[model samples]
Every structure is written in C-alpha cells, then in structure tokens.
Target: MMWRRRHIFDPFYELKRMEEWMNDLMGEMQTAGGLLLPESTGKEVAPISRVPSIDLIDKGDTLVLRADVPGVDKSDISVNMKDDMIEISAERKGEEEVKEEGYIRRERHYAKYYRAVPLPASVDKDAITAKFENGVLEVTMPKVAAEEVKKIEVK
Candidate 1:
C-alpha cells in the first residue's frame, strides 16, 4: 500500500488555497519590480537558504560548533569570528539542470540557500578552528576564561 501524506486538511489536496496564497504574494511583489523573480530564470529565484544543524557543548573553557554544510565546497566556505558573532558564508554551486520528457507539471523547484548565526558572547576569536569533511563544517571556539580571583592593593 502507498503511504499517503497527511496534511492539515481533508484527504483531497486543497491546491486552490495554495494557489491563492501565491497569487497574493506575487501581486504584492510586482510593485517592487518583481524583485523576487530572477531575470535569468524568469521565476522566483530565492537566494541560498540554510538551517542550523549544530550543537553547543560546554567544556569548562571551550565550545564546539558543528554546522551542517552538505553539498557545498569546503574551500568556498568562510568562517569569521568578531566580537560576539560567528559569521559563515559560501557560494555553493547552483543546482540548475537540463532534463527531458519527465513532466506533466514542473513546480516546487529549489535554489541555493544561506544561513547565518549570531553568537551570544565574545568568543576567543584567536582560537577559532574550522574543519570541513563529509559535507559538514565544524567550528571550534575556545572561550576566554573570566578572572576567578582578583587581588586589590590597599593604597
């Protein structure tokens, strides 16, 4: 038996509702010079998107950032640590393709994506390390330990 996808709707797919939503959005975008639509594709070409697939482990005086960067070139990825922010950027290869004879309809296409994460505190920027392997980018930043003891001289 084929598995049926369950949506927040009746068994019948309510396609018209989706169509109406898209129409409303596109209509609003038209005034903005159709900014959402790319000139090359003549359709809505969304910029690269990204998701946070990471873990933060507190190890006394350090932290580990494991980011999921699948299907991207490690060389193109850049990791930056400044003040209280961890910036990552990369130019992934576009997924445009050529195909033949395999469509009654063609929609739900995908485009590149980008994701950025902001750090909470000033990480020890000098010790930031990045490792990219098996399509995952891992960043390790050692925290600067705060002063545990203070000595005050009486004057």
Candidate 2:
C-alpha cells in the first residue's frame, strides 16, 4: 500500500486561502466597477467622496437623527422627509486663500455628503423639525399614531 500524508489545522494554509479569496473578490469588484476604492497601486479611484457620521435613535413617540457636519455652513445643509424616509444632504465649500510672503504650505478641504435614513415607524412629515448647532445637525420626527385594532368575528 502507498503511504498517505494528511495535514490538518495548518494556520498558514488557512491564511493563504483567505488571502486568495479576498483577491478574487477584489478582482471581480474591479471588473464590475462596483467599488471605487484605490487598488493595490497608488492610482486614485473616484466615486463617493465622503460619508458623514450619523446617529439614529428611536424613541417611543419620536425618532431622532443626528449628523456630524463640521466646517459646513448651516445654509448648505438640506433635509427632506418623504413617507418613512429622510434624506440629508450637505456641501462644504473651500474658501479662497491669500498667499503671504514665505508661505510654506496651505491645505483646502471640501466634501459633499448625502444619506437617506428609513424610520422604523411612520412619522408625521409636516411635524418634523431640524436644528443645527456647533456643527451638529439634529432632526426630530414625531411618530404617527397607530390605528386602533378592531375585533372581527370568525365564520
């Protein structure tokens, strides 16, 4: 009978397999153009710019959403509510700089972000209110009253 070799619980083998799987997934994503993240090379890929951090809270009678939008003017932000969805959009504009003597370096930052949040329960769109303070945007939406249950006779 020929000798047989069995290998089990090899840590490096599993790591290599995982690496191969991730490489395959990245290759497929690149081919389909679904992801615009930079590849292994230093070339820049463009698609989405940035995502503003947000926190959504669901209270018994209302839903609250807060977003971090530093360095953006309040007038540049827009909030809209439709059905059970709320969309928030904002743009940050860079200011023109005046160069002075012996200017070493200057950096300008600008970004546009948009996000849609779905509420767990129906909300009163017209009663929604929003406030912006200290670079944070807070939106409160009152939940709609639930329909009363009715008893039905069984046949």
Top-TM-score structure, candidate number: 2
Instruction: Give all candidates' CA lDDT scores.
Output: 0.64, 0.78
Q: TM-score of each candidate?
A: 0.52, 0.63
lDDT of 1 at 133: 95
Clashing pairs in 1: 48-112, 48-113, 48-114, 49-113, 49-114
Question: All predictions: root-mean-square deviation over Cα?
Answer: 13.4, 6.7
Writing each residue's lDDT as its tens digit, candidate 1 over 19-86 gives 88889988777655433534432233343344435666666677777776666777778887655777
Off by over 4 Å in 2: 1-48, 102-108, 149-155
State residue 129's C-alpha deviation in candidate 1, in Å: 0.8
Q: Tell me the spans in candidate 1 whose CA falls farther than 4 Å from its real position.
A: 1-47, 94-113, 147-155
lDDT of 2 by residue, 62-123 (tens): 99999887778999999988777888888887856668887745567667766677778888
TM-score, model 2 to reference: 0.63
Tell me which residue pairs clash in candidate 2: none
lDDT of 1: 0.64
